[model samples]
Target: MRIARLGPRGAEVPVVLHDDRAHDLRGIAPDVDGAFLGGGGLDRVRDALAAGDLPELEGADALRIGAPIARPGAVYCIGMNYAAHAAESGSAPPERLVMFMKSPNTVQGPDDDVEIPRGSVKTDWEVELGVVIGTRTSYLRSPEDAWAHIAGYVVADDLSERDWQLAESGGQWSKGKSAPGFCPTGPWLVTPDEIDARAVRLRSRVNGDPRQDSSTADLVFGIDRILYELSQVLVLDPGDLVLTGTPEGVALSGRFPYLAAGDVVELEIDGLGRQRHRFVAHEDAPEVAGA
Candidate 1:
């Protein structure tokens, strides 16, 4: 039930961790992903698994883990999906949910270090619960139908630049949010059968101190409604990701204390898992050879 994508960038393989051992679903059944997700291949893998025909993938600490889904077509995001977060940012709950997109290239492993872009300031963090779509959908009208298409969940951090987001660009939020490596995603893409997304505990700590602590219960739009809302405007595809949004304590939500160089930002969501990244200051990068 807990499937993992292990190995380094572009070399990852799907493996399921069962009973303290890593089951290499791909070993016995080469078509693991397609089969495991309820496709024709999925049924074949299931039948094989049921017959105890899969290979063992246990106890490999050296395996580098990648995001659960590879080649996610898009990374859609929600802003102020948390009621209190909206309030802290000096805004009212909108009549509708707010959305944005991060370049897919921004997606990286959950534990990857978040690099601070050169010539930038206002790097802030928003720890959010990520929803990955299992199938394509467009024009959905009800909340209940949303879950049927969701593949599972992952931990995502929407790193932002306040000034570039609000002031410098003259008001386009994506400019500040879409920087390369700005989005750190996944310890894994958990299937719903393994964890309860709604009951999860979410938290963010900066350099070992608690900052954003909340529950999925605090989300104003939640998953079902968010999918329905987004589907109404644009079509969502397999491997598309939705950021359910962050809760109350982001530095930009106005109490002002934003991130600086050398800060370590960490986020944890109950079953989905944890992610840590260091804030490297722009000035610290070595000067170019011909500068």
Candidate 2:
């Protein structure tokens, strides 16, 4: 089943899609949060669908989609997990997993407008497979344990600003990655059973020109290995998001220009779904104290 959240940003409601129509699930579960996924909500949704107990969401196509899962506990990212991406960035295949975080506030609807930070150049796009955790996971004994802990997957655009990430803000990548609307994900959440999480084709286009095109099969560190490694260091809670890195051909490779205001970025992962976001400049955002 393809699960989605629809309506305005803060007031979105969860629904499940079937026969190309969305069926409201608010009556059976709350927004797609930790409590919902951790407490067997998907099972309940499937049972209700089997019983014809759900109401079709009227005009769902016209409704604005929020991120398929509500704000997760956190959004963890794998850096350069794809061999080609690492090579393109002039680095060797990582001896150990490289990781980072995007502030939870960066979460935005799949089609929302991304803002170009003030005084910025080198804003870029990364299309990656996003793994949504369904249960508490820690120190998993082996790679085989990964599938049991995953709830589903989503398409994620991991936007970044190179200057702040590599030069200005010391060497921390998240400094340039955590901008608002940087992580636009999900037109839908596809359950694990629906697709092969390890070998999907993921691609990205900027303003109708293709930038990245590759398969998850090229990942240097596959999903299961990533999970096995990460779980040893941190507790991945229910509803947490993990961006499994991106394949080659990002603007960072010096093969294309960086994203500018008015650019439209389209990202897709086969079987998961597609996402499109327009880029805009934030010229007058108010400053916060010490920001």
Candidate 1, TM-score vs. the true structure? 0.88
List, residue by residue over 42-158, the lDDT tens digit for candidate 2: 999999999999999899999988899988889999998888889999999898999999987788889887788888888999998999999999999999998899999999988
Q: Identify the runs in model 2 with alpha carbons over 4 angstroms from their true place.
A: 284-291
Model 1 lowest lDDT segment of ten: 282-291
TM-score of 2: 0.96
Estimate the Cα RMSD of every predicted model relative to the unseen true structure: 4.1, 2.8
Per-candidate clash tally: 4, 0
For residue 32, what is the lDDT in candidate 2?
92
**What is the alpha-carbon lDDT of model 1 when measured against the actual structure?**
0.76
Clashes by residue pair, model 1? 22-57, 22-58, 35-41, 35-42
Q: lDDT tens string, model 1, 169-260?
A: 66567888887667787776777887889868999999998989999988888899999989998988877888988898888866757887
